[model samples]
Target: MTVGVEEEFVLVDPRSGVTAAEAPRVLELLKDERGVVAEFLRYQVESVTGICRSLSEVRADLTRLRGRVAEAAQDAGCVALATGVAPFARVSPVTDDPRYRRLADRFPRLIGEAGTCGCHVHVGVPSRAVGVRVLARLRPWLATVLAISANSPYVDGLDSGWASARYPLWSRWPTVRPPSAWHGTAGYDAAVDGAIRGGKAIDARSVHFHARLSPLHPTVEVRIADVCLDVDDAVLLAGLVRGLVGTALAEERRGVPLPHVPDVLVERSLRAAARHGLGGPGVDVLTGVPVAHERLAEDLLVHVRPALRATGDLEDVRSGLWALTARGGGSERQRALRAGAGTPADFVARLAATTRGGDLERKAAQ
Candidate 1:
């Protein structure tokens, strides 16, 4: 199975380090590029990797698209912040799309604080049946993945008291909750139909469960991670989700059962991960007990080790993991940076440099 990634970033001014309404310009430059696309907010842009077969392909695609967008945004006096959310931009201009207009009219609070970007991994499945099975088994580990990718710690120019502030903010969407286990493909379709029929979801696509059988693709889409900062971290997130899906599929073929974890316990774990991230303990997957994030990571690695080995991802997983922990994820890094003399402007500035492929050409002009 192949894995792909979709990431969103906030576009900002190259000089002032503030959200810039330069989506139009960036879109114009990327008109012929299918990989770079506009997002809901004018200050937001998205990069979708082509169906990638390995971590290297994922990294190459992300770097290519991110680098292109950064260059174009810089030429237009703007940059892209690869963090989960903009630190200071409280409000933003919505993209000129009817879908966004209807969303704004109906869910004002939802889109009011828009531009909470995410790192979504889409793992190809043999069919919807297999994808649904993978989704059913993926619920318990969702929080673990979130902790691994918790990038948003600041909002409105201050620490938001959550490792991934974007997680809480984005979860406000009505259908964003993790769904209960399904019996099979029929049950999965019923859940999707129920959400749309009950008005909890706008459409099949809006069945925004953290992980779901993609509405339009032959893939299980994992939408729990906050947009990662480093390209390698992005690959790590992608590989982790893919490994989970692969493990689940293998177990399914072996007639393994999805663990019967309570929904309340799963929700608690998610809250714990959002509150503490990897800096603190994470709730156990099967038992709902609290454990150190390091231990939780070890447990996760054990679960996916077979898949990693089979796919030649064991080394990347090991090394990428070390890098993630060594740097302490984006939330930790952001807090540390804020503790220093650096401000929100500086935070966005550093992220812009990362998005621009490490050549931060445009600084705050004197």
Candidate 2:
């Protein structure tokens, strides 16, 4: 399967989570590696890898890309952080980028205040029919994936209490939640057209559903997960996504009817997942009973196990999940670091160190 990865990273002062739109300056220092760096917000830069079929290749590409970016940022006296939201990001700190300016002008209330980052994984679908089918099957499991990858807990200098505040915040935009069930490509195109004509959106590209058929690519894009700081976490999440899509495709081949879930149940389940992480209460979307989030996660994992094994990624996926649960996601780690350091600035400094790729090398060496 062809896979592509896009990671959004925050540019911040080494000691502060505040926005540092110094990406342009840092890019200048790197001699402009085309296809490697793309502009996100003024305060963020995104790195994308070309299509690769193997997990090992993906990991190698990402490690090289991240290391290069970190070195460039260090040369420019800045650091890049991989997280859903920087704790100190403020609307006023957004850099003056033309696209961002347009966004601010168009959706003043929403775009002006938005500063969350995320990772989007796009796996190629052989046809548009497959794309829609994969998206439909993917919708029900969005919340579980979001919970497993909850990395953004603090926003605007305080804990947002939600394991991934980026989820709730990103859901504010119109057409930005989970995808609705559409029967085929024609139905999907019609829906996009109607939304545009009815002023619900500007164009087909604006249909920013959490898991949607990519207008620009021949793939279904999974956009709900946070930008994980640990490279292992990011890789594991991508592997799971690949497995899920593969399973959905297999089910489609078997002529399995796509399950119809109530929208209200999906929303409720997502909210609970965001609030509790894996340690808190999670609602069973099928039954609406409150249960442990970890149990729900396990059930979801079971459904995707065959796919995981087929992809030869079950071990890595399980190991990565264990690492997150044991050491805590980015939020918990940030909280622990803050408690020990006694200041947000200190915590951010530690985060910068962690993201520099040096920490992983040190761990391996030890």
Candidate 3:
């Protein structure tokens, strides 16, 4: 299966670490660059990779896009931050677009505070029916993925006590929730239409289930993860997502009935992941018992091992998980950096360094 990634980054003033509404300028600088585009908020930008058949392709494309955005942000007198939320910034004004303006008017408070960023992975499926089934199969494991990618720890200059504080904050949108085990494409379409008809979702675009069949492509889009701090981490996620989709597709072909994990359990598991990140305890999707996140990760790997091996990603995903756990995930790394920082500026400095893989230092040394 082919995959792609979409990462959202916030532009921050270099000195103060405040989110800067300079996306227009940064985007202007990136006019020659492909895959980089403005987001709903003027302080944010998004990078979309073309469909990739291998992890290396995803890495190369993501690295290039991140580097371009980082350089563009520097030219605009800001830094492109990969964290899920601005650590210390007030709500940014919405971008000047008719659709965004309509959203702003319809959900003023929600739109005002909805600057959360995320990393979305799309893995191609055979059809919308297959994609919907993949989404249903993916629900039990999405929380673990969220825990693995928890990058946002600080919110509004204070510790939010949630690893991916962006998760709950983003959940303020009416349609943002776990995907349901729909019958097939018709069921999924009906659910989306119902949300729109009931005024919960603005349109098909607003059907923000954590995992959903992509409206624009023949893929299942997984939006459960926060924007990772490193390109390698992002690629790791893409590999795992592809593995999951591949496993689900195989099961579907073998006549596997849709799994029946309870919604309440799924929500609880998600909440735990958001609250504690990877180092904390997680609920087992099957048993509803508290398990360490490491154990959860191990179980997930086991479940997808066949697919991983088939895709030649078994060792890479294994090593990546080990590295992530050893260094602590992005949330823990941010906390550690914040602990050593004498000021918010210093924290942002350290974060900005890792966000772009020390590219700035390399450029400066040159």
Clashing pairs in 3: none
* Per-residue lDDT of candidate 1, residues 22-50 (tens digit): 88888998898999888888888899999
- RMSD of candidate 2 to the truth, in angstroms, is 2.5
Candidate 3 off by > 4 Å: 358-366
On TM-score, the leading prediction is: 3
Error of 3 at 122 (Å): 0.5
Q: What are the RMSD figures for all models against the true structure?
A: 2.4, 2.5, 1.9
| Position 327, candidate 2: lDDT | 71
Q: lDDT winner among the candidates?
A: 3
Candidate 1 clashing pairs, residues 3+ apart or interchain: none
lDDT of each: 0.82, 0.76, 0.89
Q: Distance (Å) between predicted and true CA of 361, model 1?
A: 11
Q: How high is each candidate's TM-score?
A: 0.94, 0.92, 0.97
- Cand. 1 Cα-lDDT: 0.82
| Span of 10 residues, lowest total lDDT, candidate 1 | 357-366
Cα lDDT of model 2 by residue, 1-366, tens digit: 778888888877766667777877877776667545645366677888778787777787777778888888878777787778877755444456565565566566786447788888989899998898788898778877787777888888888888888888888877787778888888888878887787656667666788888888998899888887767777877887888898899899999999888889888888887777766788887787888877877787788889888878788877777776777766676666567665656667666656655665344223
Count of clashing residue pairs in every prediction: 0, 0, 0
